[model samples]
Target: MKMMAMALRRITLSPWQTALTALTIPSTTTTTTTTRPHSTLMSPPVVSLDLPDVWPPNSSHFHFPPPINYSNGHRAAVIDGKLIAEEIRSRIGSEVRRMKESIGKVPGLSVVVVGQRRDSEIYVRNKIKACEQVGIMSTITQLPDDCTEEHVIDAVSSFNVDPSIHGILVQLPLPQHLDEGKILDAVSLEKDVDGFHPLNMGNLAMRGREPLFIPCTPKGCIELLIRSGVEIMGKKAVVIGRSNIVGLPTSLLLQRHHATVSVIHAFTKNPEHLTREADIVITAAGVPNLVRGNWLKPGAVVIDVGTNPVEDPSCEHGYHIVGDVYYEEAVRVVSAITPVPGGVGPMTVAMLLLNTLDSAKRAYEFS
Candidate 1:
């Protein structure tokens, strides 16, 4: 099996180097350069944000200028995932219509839910709704938690052979009684638009090969960066976590785009220091607000894939969804950032639609 290129060099910092990189950006600009006191290891780095117009005056700002928008008001540009996802879906809808008119076939997506988990149900419902809005046929098959592995596989097998179904997804977090891997392995790869099949993963990891589908969330993260005009080629990028679904695949995709990549997981020491060296950061670690402003390189672009719920007394639900990066702090520091609830969630669904549409076109050889 091909491996993702290990190109991200580990960084060691001196006292001055640490001070220069970790300093907090000032809310305003200044005419003269200034130096800042070094912060202790226990505290975040503090540097003078006020740099003189003259070059090499006070401190080095990550070898790059502070974000253009940050100087205006310490306000980072908000990447609106909702609008981008909506436009993608609209374009998919138009393509679906064209395919249907010319080839007499529309895309179809089938979601197989194994149990009554509320979260799984909600996800399936949203997916089905998205398919509907895009004019793709949606099918849902809900089995009981006690259902045997064979039973679930049987459902998948039926969808695999059915002429009407073009894409098949087995809702994740299968009950404890079932073998998730065996069942997932049974799904025909051609219909595996989720891109979870081992072959697809292998293709994604190989330099010259291509996966039939890129996993939705990671694809969405890259889409947001590309659409927002963040350069990826020859840039430094860090992806937090190493899960097969998000982190591992995301790192591979970044490498495919020619960005030098690093993946920091629970085992990584001083993750903040490594992250601060990156020009582009895509964080999928589930821990809520795990990334702070001080962890970022000034003018870095952040794409947060975490959606953790934290208690909130002010909201009606008493819970709010937040990404791994601290929004309040990161926005002021990074050049561009994505919001938790709206950032990657919508794009995942949009990519699913595109994948299903692609499946239909492949089936009919219309594309």
Candidate 2:
């Protein structure tokens, strides 16, 4: 029982724990908070502040640079996710430097990769690169494709107790021979930067509870929407796909922002019909061109999370990536849209850095 109490206290110190609390509790000035009864989906507590009603109520903290070099030829404003991601990374880098200077400590991330899948290798490589750019120390434990589940668990356990390591990530899609759930459960809750732990997901689903870390991809989707100045509260949002990684958590996040959300999956009939009525659409169906122009409501904001590889001999690589929504058609219809390659991809990595930095701050009790 003593061990469990200690663990619970550690989880409560996550930086995200205060994101809603800051707004929910009124201040001395003209700010007032009005919270309704919690719904089944656990909508966030709504607060009315004296400041402007923007996507991110606390934009002053980020000091985001003005959007630049965006494509304007289309009817819809192209959301430059890559540029926003760069800006976020810059802020994270600065914060990392400050932490090191004040406390003589930097964030550290550990990744355990089991297989030799080409896509997984690229993902791991990009994560390591992002850590390097943000001044975070990263270590990798590469196991053979046929390694036993115990081997993977042992590696993760080693990092969990390491004071120097603030984040522990186990690369997904483990070998068929391994038990994925057991391996994931082996990661300590305090260091589960991937946010796949059951406890973290449970907190995310509850009304007043906050997760230590939001899953990187889902968190990235929300960041893209907020930076683009899309108003989420009281809007009709539709999520395509219901996978644990990007789809399910994303819908939950949208609800947290007070958006009325609908989810479309393989079993859902006439998915496009439901999508066409949404003010905002986030599709991660992984089926390229699944969402066409006709599927969207005019003036709707679209975030394409799908990155399906299609053969393109004309391109430098053997294949090129396409999104669930057909861009050429979407650009002309929606008021705003994120392109496939430059959209959610970079934001995912940036969010990981943010989570790692937050973890380290909690570990060292840094402000």
Best by lDDT: 2
Clash pairs (backbone) in predicted model 1 = 23-47
Q: Write down the TM-score of every candidate.
A: 0.77, 0.78
Mind giving the per-residue lDDT tens digits that candidate 2 earns over 236-290? 9999988777888999999999999999875455666788889999998777787
Candidate 1: worst-modelled 10 consecutive residues by lDDT:
50-59
Local error of candidate 1 at 332, Å? 0.9
**Local distance difference test, each candidate:** 0.82, 0.84
Please provide, for model 1 over 265-362, each residue's C-alpha lDDT reduced to its tens digit, 9 standing for 90 to 100: 75456777899999999998777877878789889999998877777889766777788898988988888999988888889889889988898888
Candidate 2: lDDT of 183?
87
